[model samples]
Target: MGLWLPNLEYLNLGSNQLVGSFPMSISNASRLRVLNMSHNYISGSIPDTLGNLRNLEMLNLEANNLTSSGMGFLSSLTNYPALELLSFGDNELISGELPGSLGNLSSTLQIFFAARCNIRGSIPDSVGELINLVSLDLSANNLSGDIPRSLEQLRYLEYFNVSFNRLDGKILDGWSFGNWKNIANLDFSGNNFSGAMPDRICDLNSGLRYLGLNDNQLEGALPLSLINCTDLVILNVAKNRLSDTFPHWLGALPKLRVLVLSSNRFHGSIQDSIATSFFTKLQMLDLSSNAFTGLLPTNFFHNLKALSEVVEYEYDNYRYSVNVTIRGLELPFTITVAIPVFTCIDLSNNGFHGEIPEAVGELSMLLALNLSHNSLTGPIPTSFGDLAALESLDLSFNKLSGSIPSQLTSLTFLEVLRFQNNNLVGHIPRGKQFETFENKSYAGNLDLCGFPLSKECSNGEGSETEKHDQVNGKGMAFIWKVVLMGYGSGLVFGISMAYVVFTTGRPWWLVRMIERDLKEKIRSWIPKKKRN
Candidate 1:
């Protein structure tokens, strides 16, 4: 179109076969407000003159083959006092630093994104100059150096993500746990941030909701300050070097929904408060890959109102006596009580033994339950069928026995059911959700039979019991034959020994009689020999 529509306020030709450098004629559309030509075959540097559209408010030219020189095209947009949102993500642009001129944009700007553009170097301190910025995303870049402390100047900022960068240094003093009181979503994951968690992190209370600090070098005990943030919904601090007992303060957060503290150096018994008190609104909780022990509370699922509120509470009270009493009599009075509600609970990978509680199915809103890799025994509760919304259930590597619950087929929405490496017996349930699972899901249960497994159910003619009886009969027959042969051989040996001993007793007299008869015959024959 070559900017033929000068009156155009919005222009979008994205994902087309358009080619060549940006048309400089676009600068003629001084009234243009929105421009998008992303995912096209456009190449070469962006037109610096195109930024003359003073009324332009939103611009997206992402996912193209635009090169480094195109970065200069952005600096011209600073002249637009009305510009509010800008996105240049997912382009093969060369590495560069964020333009300091970006700080000069009008305070009316609300959203800014420059992810995956090879932008490197530290975030400019000038970023604090955009006081009205609400959402900022600089993720998936090569940016390095410390997160600027000046970021605390953004009092109105709500969502911020600097993940997947090479940024190093401790989380800035105020931003670490103190200043971001209005932040609802903060993702500093996939960075080189180090040091102990600041104590004031959870002091934001109802304002700070989702906190993701995983895959960092953060250490030290989980700060007790977390209990102060009664409005926290999701807390993820996985894959760090943190060392301490399981944090008990988690159970006190009134609104916590998802708590993931995996792959750390936490040790000690999983406190009963985990299951009995906290997590009332929890939907997904993963505490796997730690060194925890102790029996899981039997009533772990008893208090979950929606499988989300799984934190604990503190109670206190006071009493006083008044000096002026009615009718010249002295009187005193006192009252006390405080209660916290916790909903969902996950105590897997701990050394918990005994049967899973039937009350676990009471969590009607439970969506994902992972009790795998523990010492839990006994049959899976039939009550599990009551979880109408259950989506993912894993009970692998436990000592659980008995038949797979036929009622489990009621979990129509279940996408992942892992029950491997258990002692479960009986035929695998047929039809519906059971048939969808592969043999691996039911492996390590040698006594289990039916479809999906190689072993077939026993019939009357060749039942395992009948085969055992047949083998026992053959063994008895062989033993009896060996005994008869031994008795016959012993009789023959005894008879032969007795005959020899009796026959030799009269042998000497028989020898003398024979000698006298032989002497007479010899005397007659000797006389004839002498004559010869």
Candidate 2:
């Protein structure tokens, strides 16, 4: 009776909670072109009868408990002549080496996804036989060993993600990386790729957009050819052994936005005298945990034209990530909400010395700026108040002196401000957001005395008594700025208000009454003048 529908082309019973082993009788539809039983409770080995479906074009058994100790099932699927998309991901597969027969899959295959499959051993060299493949995602597996050079033959491959694995070896100089000219998204992160990045990397893909090689041991200077990939948008090579000056040449890439080179051995001053280009569209620039010195590149920051404009960003379907506090826990900000708020400049843990640049205030869209752990001196830049979007500012552990900029109180969105361990003097700024900060925010700055701190100023220095509070600098500790926090602005205003009311509200006010009473007392003392 099953043979009555021998010409059935589609059989989709997905997500039906169907239990028990995948039935072998499905192959009776000899001309079946699409077979999908994914997201079910199917178990047991795949029957070799599936190979009988010669015309099968799409096979999806993903998100099922499909575990088979046999190795023929993977190879059997190769028998189809029109098979293009094969997805067996998110399944509990039997632990075994991926069969080499997968290399025999039809050349028409384009998308192969086996991520999170408990497949062990090295990736089969025969995988390169799927020459027409476009997207290959075998991530979250225990697959190790170097990628075979034969993969270079896949000229049409577009997206390849082998992240979250133990694979090692240099990505270039071995494989014909030069042949991946059409590849757009390549993620080799979470591996042990070492050695200097190839100098001719740009020769591989002229239109590549996202390149992620982070969490590796890659060393040496950034390939100068990297800037030639003018279409690059996100370049993440963080957590490596890379050592070089700031790759200011990256500014040449017009479409570049997110560039992360954090937790590396990159050294030398970031500022360059002759570079005329600008990272106009850059939103996230992280160079923390390096050896960078000298003042920040004010000229370069001035050219971040995207930052100077009003709040506008291009993160619609895409995502941006940076370290942030999520529910009181430090975590990566990877939310996909419609908020397009993601811009930071991290130069912390470097040897940078000099005043915080006023040019940084030009980035009206910046959300976080970390200039901590440097030798930076001079007062906190008053221009920081212009950053209406700033939420985090770390100016700690510097040689910065002078009073805290009162203008900083204008930062309404500021939630994190660390001025600890600086040489700043004078009373800390008062009012608004300043009042919310605790004593620790101004700790180590002994000269700063204010409400949050226990130290209070001498008496009679309130705003109303400023004229009488003056004393010799050598004879007494002359206080210049009257602390508005301890004595209170409302108290001074109340006294001034009382003075105005008593003097004007009555014809015989306190001043007139006192003068009259004093004159009569003097007349009584002189009796002869009173009798006359």
Candidate 3:
């Protein structure tokens, strides 16, 4: 394809349905600087001949079916002194470890991505030589071993992700990460990294926005130095062995939006919000599966102003995603504060008690709320009807009592409701989204009776009573039988028996006895006038 355009300087054939092997003739374009063939069906190894383009600055071949036994092509590209960006992510056929010579690439290289390339072995310490790297992603591979302390040399690194790998060892224990001054997004999630998190890592430049160290073996309290990162937006250290009380000081960060500390050994009660602005901008808060106790933070709920508003941010593209449990299944959800959707609050599976705060209903834009598996009591707040954007609501396994607020029927977006195993009573709310819920939503609430449940509410009349079969057979005979049976027995049981008899066909002998003994039976059961 390069035969006709030997002087081609730019080629972006991405996002097309292009098929077949990588075009070998493209090497003829010696002046080509930017080459992108991403999101295509291209196959075969990236030919080393393309390295002939000495003027090449960017190369992206992501999301292709390309195969490569090793990343030898990367070595060939080192000839291009001007090479700044290199990406070959999402090519599962690319196997083997990153060659140590990868550090021999041009110092001008600022972004390198080899994610999901089936790569193995530890990251080479030589990677520290890439001083100009602003972003490096080697996630979703078979990578093992600890992060090299040499990575601290990337003073300009802004984004670094090595998640979903088999990496282990303390995250550079005791080594100060002070050189990562420009680092903004750091993700080491889904790994086996253990040991207490070193507090010095928080010494990095305060521009740090996202810090994800989830699904690891990190222990000890969250670093207090994190409060220095005023720009921090998303901090997820969930599924770790972190043993600390609630880090309420995090609320001091104005930009913090998503804070997930679930599945840790964190204990103690979450205190009330100390300031009105505390956690005001936070949108997603997940503290599930911990040893936390005390009342549902009422004042804290009042401070979550962002969850109630339709906030639009300047950084709309920087969406932070988190896993949320819905109906016992964990699902990932991309949460963007710029968008009005997907705001969530999960405090389930804790030792929290006391009534859920009425202020919680102030979060009218909340999409998912899970407070299940706690010792929470008191009736659900009627104010919950104001949660107009709510989709999933789970208050199960609590000591919550009182009838469900009928006001909940106003929630048009309500789809998943779980009030099971509570002390709720009275008829379950009907109509609107409530009608769509099954009996399971109200299960274990023995006193709750209505539609989806087999148990019917007492004192039901009109349509409720009409639901039962009408009494048949001779109407007069039925009345006489009821009177003879003693009026004090109540008409409900008498009607039920009469209806059964009529439906099954009455025995003439029993019918005759009822008809003849009607008077005699009444007289026998009645006492004569009180003796004087």
Candidate 4:
């Protein structure tokens, strides 16, 4: 069998349970152009002899156990002068420093995916040599240190990712950004990059679609230059030190969809300066853990047309994810074919007040909505029944009063409902999702009385009338007691006055005094004529 398939141009044994170290005999296939053995149980060190396949154009051994003892095997890869693609990612045991020889790959190499290989130490600056490389991913590793600036030389590089690593330092400017006019996706999330983000990012070529710089220490106001990037779809700057007001102007971007500014210092009211402004296509809007205040704009919900309509887009083998907080848990949401839809609005832990907007119920496609830990008051809108697709709703730690809407019971998909520590009262609507809700959902509302709560209500008119009669009888009895007390006091006063007159009878002395006074007055009076 040695010479039987010596000219094999392609050998694909992907997704099989294949195992063991690299087959050194493959070197005999001198003309092998493509070899794919990914998604297998392959183990042990990759053989250095694999480098002998000179005309190999693509080598994909990803999702395996290609553990290497040293840098020699990576260095040997330089021999494949025709290699245009290298895929060695997700090999959990492939541990060691990235060899400088990685940069020696043929200039024809256009795509390199070596992520999650558990490789240690900094990326070598020599990676700059792959002038024709289009995509590079090195995420989910323990690698640290500034991304090698020399990567600036890969003018054709479009998709670059170094997320979920311990990489530190500023996302310094001047990394061949000007050359990749066709750059579509760039993710630098989940790292320790600090300092002000370079504003030059807005000056780059225009086809950019996704930009992620979340979970970093970057600060300062959001760059106004972002207005130029009208094609941006997903922009995540959450979990950073950015201290800007709400970026309302971003609403002008016609295609903008996912916008996450949580865990930052974004302040001010969500505005609606332009009726149909920025969020025309937005699917998720998270501004939680900030200083936002005032009523959610009157037209805020009306403008998010995407939230009201059903939007379906495939990730198409790409991981399009955004982190959102649902029911006190931080979860990463990704677009997928199975569920393919997620529209959310999270404005929790701020100063938002007044009634929960009735228009919010218009978001028929919403999956999760949270407005907890705010000063909000008034009734939970009955219109919330319109959120037929809602799975989670949180309105806890607020001043919301009035009865729980019976209309909300129509939300059959609701899995988590929380209204604890609010002023909600009366019966909690029953049936559907309401039946699944626990007592805690209505706790801290003293006026609330229902099946889940300990308080019970009078069911019939006779029972209610009996209660009213009992209260009325008590009130009438108190009023009669006051009247009787007043009548008795008047009788006692009349008797006392009669007794005073009878007890002071000095008749003779009174008569003598009256006669003396009359005589004295008659003697002293005289007419004027008698006096003349």
Give the candidate number with the greatest TM-score.
3
TM-score of 3: 0.83
The digit string of per-residue lDDT tens for model 1 on 115-213 reads 778888889887777777766778779989987777887877766779879987877655554455666667787798899865776555636666778
Q: Rate the local accuracy (lDDT) of all candidates.
A: 0.63, 0.68, 0.75, 0.70
Q: What's the lDDT for residue 79 in model 1?
A: 71
Q: Please write out the lDDT profile of model 4 over residues 231-320, one tens digit for every residue.
A: 777788989999988888888887777788988988887764775655768877888888988987758788887777655544322224
Q: How far is candidate 2 from the true structure (C-alpha RMSD, Å)?
A: 22.6
Model 3, span 1-532: residue lDDT tens: 4365777988878768999999999988888888878779999998989878888877888889999888778778765788877888889999877767654473777778788899999998878878888778898899999888888889888778898999999887777777887777778899999988767766754577778899999999998988888888888898999999999999999888888999999999998548888998887888999999998777889888888766655643343344444433344443332344246898999999999888898887687899999999987887787787776799999999877776677776676789999998777767777777888889999888889889878776323322321221111111101001111110011111231132334312122212333444435433342211
Ranked by lDDT, top first: 3, 4, 2, 1
Worst 10 residues of 4 by lDDT: 482-491
Off by over 4 Å in 4: 1-4, 103-106, 174-176, 311-319, 327-330, 336-341, 460-532
- Select the stronger candidate by lDDT from 3 and 4: 3
Ranking by TM-score: 3, 4, 2, 1
What TM-score does model 2 achieve against the real structure? 0.74
Q: Residue-pair clashes per candidate, as listed?
A: 27, 0, 0, 1
Candidate 2: where are CA atoms >4 Å away?
A: 1-55, 60-73, 91-94, 176-178, 310-329, 334-341, 425-443, 447-532
For residue 49, what is the lDDT in candidate 3? 90
Q: For model 2, how does the per-residue alpha-carbon lDDT over 130-230 read when each residue is reduced to its tens digit?
A: 98887687877888988877788887776677876888888756554666787766778888888987676577556676678888899999988897787
Q: What is the C-alpha RMSD of each candidate to the true structure, in Å?
A: 37.1, 22.6, 23.1, 35.0
